[model samples]
Target: MNDKFFIQAGALLGAVAVALGAFGAHALKAMLETSGRADTFETAVKYQFYHAIGLVLIGILLQNCAVNAERYYHWSGYAFLVGVVIFSGSLYTICFTGIRAFGAIAPIGGTLMIIGWVLLLLAAGKK
Candidate 1:
């Protein structure tokens, strides 16, 4: 995707993360505590927020930097987006639905996040 897309997505995701965090803390607090998934929900929100910032940074880099590996920035942004969706999304689903099976998908998202960082590093190493 383009830099603009990444910036918009990041901004939107960041907003959603904030809203969800507040909802979890206020509205869903009792349910989350009852389900013993409050920490998991917090984790999801934290990671989503962190990676949302990362996505914004990636977009800014793509827009302002003159790295020889521009394509890596694109891929890295995509990876971060997908990773946050899958990883944080799955954790959210598990917290809400009490389905442990979704935990299995988190690793894939974590891996994608790692790959995104590695790609960013590769891009930094180039030109």
Candidate 2:
């Protein structure tokens, strides 16, 4: 896999995370407070930041390591990308739209994130 793809995705995710965090802290503060979802929004941003960093690490590992172990990194990194969108995106949408249905999808993202971590573990064991 092209290392640039993972790196770019990670960078973009990190930048978006910061923007979303600030948006939550400022613009969405009042709404979230009124809806009692301030903590939930913050959680979404926090997890995004965490996975963004994880993606960057995956990119770095892929860049430096041999191709033999790229599959795990590839899978894990992509999983994280999807996970962030599904998990964090669900929370953000729910918080903003007051649509409780989105919450049901958050676990799928969380599960994907877990799978990413498990893939990372498998990648490590491969070495």
Candidate 3:
């Protein structure tokens, strides 16, 4: 259940990250560079990749860890996914739209990601 979902989600996210990275580097490179937003695009890709990896890890942990805390990992996996979407997704949009206002949405995603990490930690502590 959680295992398959998280693993599949992670794989999909990883593939998307790769594609997005390439798109940014080649397709949007000129535009982003001209707009001084190449770094922003890279940052979005980086966060996506990082959290994609986290999803994979959460999947593995949820599948194995016997801490009676599958719920924590479950939610953590979801948090990571949502965080990537909100955080990286917003940044991606900002780069394309030149709307700095979207930047405000990133911190909410960051907070979700942090909560996900804390949930993972709590998962380990369960008896």
Model 2 TM-score, 2 decimals: 0.95
**Model 1, clash count?**
0
Candidate 2 residue runs with Cα over 4 Å from true position: none
lDDT of 3 by residue, 1-127 (tens): 5688998899899999999999999988999999999999999999999999999998988877775799899989989999999999999999999999999999989889899889989988986
CA-lDDT, candidates in order: 0.93, 0.91, 0.91
Top candidate on TM-score is 1
Best by lDDT: 1
For 1-127, candidate 1 gives per-residue lDDT tens digits of 6789989989999999999999999999999999999999999999999999989998888887665778989999999999999999999999988999999999999999999999999988877
Using Cα atoms with residue i matched to residue i, what is each candidate's TM-score against the true structure?
0.96, 0.95, 0.94
**Better by lDDT, candidate 3 or 1:** 1
The list of candidate 1 runs beyond 4 A from truth reads none
Clashes of each: 0, 0, 0
- How far residue 123's Cα lies from its native spot in candidate 1, in Å, is 1.0
Better of 1 and 2 by lDDT: 1
